[model samples]
Target: MTDKSKKVTENSDFIITLNSLTRFVLGAVGGYNMQTKLKGVREMNDGSIFNSSHTLEIEKDLLLFFNTWVDIQGDKFSNDRKGFQLVTTLIQALGLVFHHIWHCCSNMSKTERTHQIYIAAKKLAQINYSRDAEHWKNCSFLTLNEDDLNYKVNSGGSTTRKHFARYLCSKIGFNY
Candidate 1:
């Protein structure tokens, strides 16, 4: 594929995968959810019991994965946002998945722990993603009605999203 086409493809994968994983964290698999997007919580869906220890462990693991992925992805995807944004677009989507999962995307800081993830990411990547973070400084960064459910991202139809979903599954020790 041409360089431009390759970029588009890669970026598409990144977004689709990100959205799927975020929804999974929010307890959705069939499609994207906006109403209960971190606004609601239900029983654990990972087949594992929900306890303080498990939750803490998952948070730690997710944060580590986010940082490591960003550090390595910068080489593969592109400069800026640690290769999270493979192409130039209006959306600042690099750390968005993490925010979405943690429900800290709102402009108003959600909690000390969630806010620290952003700080920690900066410390680890040594890149200033403040602009993108500000852009997504809301409960939902994707509001065009396009980034969540449509575009064949979260419906179990693509390889990239599938891979991310599997990773999330593994994080919870869920056999998928």
Candidate 2:
């Protein structure tokens, strides 16, 4: 076979295997197939107990696998649109799934957190995200200027909203 045809076959096979694995993992955790999706405290069609701890552990393992796979194979798929999409979608979906699980398990949901940040942000005039989230998280910056304060990098996802809000506050000489 030509190199391109061989690569296409490999990519197709990988996609099929990944989809099957995702369905199996979801089913094992919730006792229902992915088609009939369910999350925390939601009723499964089969009425089986959803073992959340087990699910988290399994999901953690999958997360690690995906992280490592991306680290190793991300470049191989970069030039191939289908392969890149498959890899990225798998990683993004798994990240979102884990985030949802974390939100369900946490006392504070992302929305609540964002609201709290919004209230804090109201005190300051800054509305847009304009600082590195790590500054707020660490809360130990030797010196910060107005220009340095309101810059956003790597700011997306539920967890970062609060961080972004805090960053915004920091830009206006507010410590959050």
Candidate 3:
């Protein structure tokens, strides 16, 4: 049987690359809607608190999508009601980041997607790490990369913004 005509036996074979799957999910015209949603997420007191159920739904979706790949054990913080709340809050923060990424390149052509992702990466880096424009522009995006969920959080389950930012960026294929 020819490679092109062979029937796939595994579900994993259906997805050749994460970017391709992401591209399919973020279809043409998805950017505008994502942008509007991002504005809403941003307006929700920086996604630390979710008031709308619609936003909550999207946040849940984001968590499912993300955790399906790399399980972010919120229990890493602690094991109790407070840990549960911590997990939910962390999911909300990451959902905002996912929305921001989709909003950046969802409507762009393949040729322009890298540039858009780069811009998004730079902006994210600025938000979480450095404010210097030239520094990020010249630095490697991989510099932001780290282990999936093992980050330095204080006793209260709080961490720097860069931790989540880098994980999402790395998983989303931000390499330079």
The 10-residue segment of model 1 with minimum total lDDT is 27-36
Worst 10 residues of 2 by lDDT: 121-130
Better of 1 and 3 by lDDT: 1
Which number leads on lDDT?
Answer: 2
lDDT of 2 by residue, 22-119 (tens): 43355334432331343455454456555565566445444443344344444543434333123222333333333333333346665554444333
Tell me the whole-model lDDT of each prediction, alpha carbons only: 0.36, 0.38, 0.35
lDDT of 1 by residue, 75-129 (tens): 5334343322332221122223343344433354446545555454444344322
* Shift of residue 76 alpha carbon in model 3, Å: 12
For candidate 3, write residues 1-176 as lDDT tens digits: 12342221233233123332332232211321322242233223233433445344344444344543233333332233222113322333344455566455557764465455444434442332222222333323223224533222332212322334344455456531
Instruction: Name the runs in model 1 displaced over 4 angstroms.
Output: 1-39, 46-54, 78-160, 163-176
TM per candidate: 0.29, 0.26, 0.28
Report how far residue 116 has shifted in candidate 2, in Å. 43
Pairs with backbone N, CA or C atoms under 3 Å apart (clashes), candidate 3: none
